[model samples]
Target: MAGKSQAGGERIEHPFDPLFNEYSRVLILGSFPSVRSREQNFYYGHPRNRFWKVMATILNCPQPQTVEAKRALILEHHLALWDSVAECEISGSSDSSIRGVRPNDLSIILKKCDIRRIYCNGRKSYDIYRRYIEERTGREAVLLPSTSPANARCGTEELINRWSVITKDLQSQK
Candidate 1:
């Protein structure tokens, strides 16, 4: 279905595209895009999500309001963003109901870049990667608390604190 319309009559071909750089030092995997996120075409673009805010605070970068700025942040910090699932015909955003976890084509990035570490944004993502991708690739990944607004159990400060531990390498490399 090329350029199919959503229930709200908004035209969309697919969710946001995966992003990575040639010299990426780390990869952050999300489970799947929410409907709002799919419409916006960016990761954690939802205002309430606070992922960019947390990352900006942790990395000492300005809050990214636009997709270009977010891409710039990833490029500037050598961070990559993509989901564990490639393209699943799922009904909604709930990861528990996710099926057919067809792994994403990482060859383009893997061939061109040096990926030092893989970080899953949430437990659902990590679980999917463990079952689908990591088993095949033999690549171990570190799991971080989910930054989605849905994961209110882990507050922004806690999320950033956990993320800081993993991203210490990024600071060292700079």
Candidate 2:
């Protein structure tokens, strides 16, 4: 799927590597990186996005303010971060605009880590993962409400409540 690009004739590809380690027990997947996230080379780079806020609240930790802090948060919690799509054509930050989907090889992380549960951050991620990765991996991801600013339907309390499942599972493992 091709579309007009914001940068003349150039289409954007996913710009960052997946974040995971041998310690990762849970994998959290987004649809793809937004333009801002690509620029910042990190997941949830947009300041207005509530991903970090929701994560901080769920984990009872300070909100991550830097790339290092964000990495630390995920690593410390045995969480892995990645996107469902490895590469795609997108007009902007909109997930709806994504096309030419080439999904990430989740097995890279799956093989390296003992990931017990997989979680998708929003509808698109969940749908893609369900359609592609789940069948091959035999691991169905729990779909969580998006932390994107666009998803105004779920407020902080609701997000916190819904996202508690991740933390709950983490606790049970301990």
Ten contiguous residues minimizing lDDT sum, candidate 1: 1-10
Report the lDDT tens digits of candidate 2 across residue range 51-130. Answer: 99999999999999999999999999999999999877676788887766778889899999899999999999999898
Point out where model 2 deviates above 4 Å. 1-10
User: TM-score of predicted model 2?
Assistant: 0.93
Which candidate leads in lDDT? 2
User: Against the true structure, what is each candidate's TM-score?
Assistant: 0.86, 0.93
Alpha-carbon lDDT, every model: 0.76, 0.89
Q: What lDDT score is found at residue 65 in candidate 1?
A: 82
